[model samples]
Target chain A: MNTHIRVAPGDLFGDGVFETIHLRPDGPWLLHEHLARLVRSAAILGLPEPDLSELPAFTGEDIAVPGVDPGSDVPRALRIIYTGGRVHTAVTPIPPAVLRERRDGVRVITADLGVSVRRRPPWSISSAKSLSYAENFAARRWAVRQGADDMIWFATEGYALEAPTASVVWLAGGELCTVPPAEAGILPGITAAHLLSLAPSVGLRAAERMVTLDELVAADAIWLASSLRGLAEVTELDGKPRPHSPWTPRLLTLLGFPATS
Target chain B: MNTHIRVAPGDLFGDGVFETIHLRPDGPWLLHEHLARLVRSAAILGLPEPDLSELPAFTGEDIAVPGVDPGSDVPRALRIIYTGGRVHTAVTPIPPAVLRERRDGVRVITADLGVSVRRRPPWSISSAKSLSYAENFAARRWAVRQGADDMIWFATEGYALEAPTASVVWLAGGELCTVPPAEAGILPGITAAHLLSLAPSVGLRAAERMVTLDELVAADAIWLASSLRGLAEVTELDGKPRPHSPWTPRLLTLLGFPATS
Candidate 1:
């Protein structure tokens, strides 16, 4: 957590993009996909493509070195930030709230994000994971103030969208599904996409389709997926209690994440 | 620009607030109003209140001294940024583009921001001038790609809001007016406010009104007011040519900015 980084004053305006990877005992998981997305996010922000050649390799031996942490077995969060001027990398312990949400499930609510899926502006950066995250944090804070663990956003048309920092993934009739990112103009969720890709191996079908909030509420299970939390089940949505699905532990194991978080 | 700044990794998330003052040969302009707005922005972002007692004095002698530029007559942009953890100050020359826009008028376009004026969520940060400026910059880029200099945002209801980085002010029938910030849910413009306050001195009536795009188009003159670019006349809007405003120089002079920019 103690590190020194320098950036120009112009960089403070959030004209950048970032990626958060799960640093595991085996090294950073899904490294290639995250890096590729980092490049895509940078382009969406109109930033020059970062030079990946200068980045340190995410090998297990390199990760075991003392500069970041001296051979610590505990997993860490690896963050790569790219402003137009500099590319910065930092590693830190995962927040306790992420672990809590992953283990205990989340009390979820639904809020109208006040956006129309039909009329997104041409310069829309919703599909890019840019660093202008104040609105995202503000949304989460508003959710917490409402006595909820987290909230999901729905468009004006009643179409279910994603969360502040996670993608919505749900199970319905043995099919694993997530909202189509490009069509919905949302950041493509790496973890949710990876989970759906693994669904067939778990004997479940995978698909990307738009779902209304009411239809989503009727699904067997709903989870918020991200790199850090992995998956947090929506145990209670909009004050309605949903019984824990038996598939929670099975899906976590399928994703190579410990069910205990 | 050669100074160094240190910040925590968490500060990169655009969770802070900032103020850009038009530094003058005498001192920073509208110091008290800018500081008050900075505090208001901080509160909207849920950041701790900034302590003004620790801020440096804004005296003419201090400004004339070498800490910034000894005996320099050129105006500088004085920026005060505040994260919950720290307050940072920096001085730098204004961008050449701002000066160019002020001297020469800007070609502006109108776009639907896709945000509903009536449905902004409880945690909406639209009124707060937070550092989450990626979308703002992105919107302006979109305008440039469309062969325009800048863009003005309008609500889905067709009511004009504000520019990406400036306030929309127009003159009609000897009246000076701008969109009401609180009602429109946009950041209040410091320069626009100051100018409107001095409208009586210029033999003009000042008011706040929610104007539609059509109504704005019929106005006698339109200008985008900001700290650095005191007043940039919108000479061309949405491909339609507008006559050069004779009041541009008068308004700029009234605001204490050089008529030549």
Candidate 2:
């Protein structure tokens, strides 16, 4: 990716939508799903339909893209950012910390998002992956300061919603579950949703649930799911240690991530 | 000002702070107060103190800077955007719509912000002029689509909080009042505060108080206060027409804005 891009000052105000995809040797994982979401997000912001014809087209199964080095074992992060006026695409190397988190798991905390799910503004854009991420970044920074690697956000009344940058996924009563976006009023997570759809193949039932913090703590296993991280096991939640879940490697491999990690 | 700037891809995420000042022939309006708030906002985001020493030093009163035209009658819009890593400043001619809004008044509507002031996360940046303004822009876009010129945001319980890019100020009984930033969890409006401080000189008392939407509708006169527009009287509220407020001109002139609009 270029180190710098030219932009009008107004473009810096975060009035845009973007998606990050895991670019493996076989091309971007769930590329179609991510593109579809980008369009939905743009509509929510009243932005024009993005012209994505320039992208390589594929059907059903993922294929090796012309851009990727087939010999390379490491995956890249492919990002597409679209405002009303422009679309920018960049391919970047995945960070070492992301890989490390997936390998060793993360320490987590829960915080109230201070928003009312029932009273969301008629024009609320919280469900879109918009570029206004200062608060999201601030929340993550606060978690780091509190000595946790990450945090899960809940609406007032104690319902677990999502992490600052990931989706909350857990195993409870032999079912694989994630929060439903519309009810939770959060960005729909492509990684988590796709993982749950594949749960049946791993002998697990898929479900969408609204779990409270206490309920989440009592789950069999918890993970934060995202594009690059795949699934980062929650090793510790709210200062309490949890045992390693054997299902971590199984789910990672199911999502096309390196299972050994 | 340059038409475009160089920026890293990460910089476009809106993890920054900004301030827009009304740059009159006498220089930036409320320059000191704006700078002070800018620092306070940076601190809220855990950013380092912005190196503002490069800006022309001024004390007490605004002054004509070496960069502005001495004979120019029109005031420019001066802006400062800081993102911990960099500070950028620009000066440009004010837009005609801002002038028109000041002169003709605006048709306004109110919407629920869906946030809880009491339950707000400890890392809330609502009191800071952070650059994550996608929702603010989205709200304004929604208002325009509904055929209104601007909007006032309210907390879930009907408390009138603020406008998308301005502060809520109104005349109640004999007092000139604006919403208190700390209580409302809105950004402290430099223009509104300065206007209130000068109210006593105009034979009116100043105050900061919370009022509900029903109470706001009954106000003698209401105006949205900001740096560029100065004061935009609400000509209509929620489809109900309002008579022109006689004090609009008086307040504009007092704030160094042209009384003639």
Q: After superposition, how far is residue A116 of candidate 1 from its true place, in Å?
A: 0.9
All models, DockQ values?
0.80, 0.78
**When only chain A is evaluated, what TM-score does every model earn?**
0.95, 0.93
Off by over 4 Å in 1: A64-69, B60-69
Q: Is the docking of candidate 2 incorrect, acceptable, medium or high quality?
A: medium
Question: Which residue pairs come into collision in candidate 2?
Answer: none
Per-residue lDDT tens digits for candidate 2, residues B47-151, read 899999766553323333335564666556777888887687766667898999999999999988888767778888889998889999999999998999999
A1-261: candidate 1 lDDT, tens digit per residue: 246567666778888999999988777889899999999998888889998887787766655423644665556788888887657888777788998888888999999999999999999889988889999999898889899989999998889899999999999999999999988889999999999999999899999989998889899999999999899999999999999988888888887889996
Give the range of the ten consecutive residues with the poorest summed lDDT in model 1 chain A. Answer: A60-69
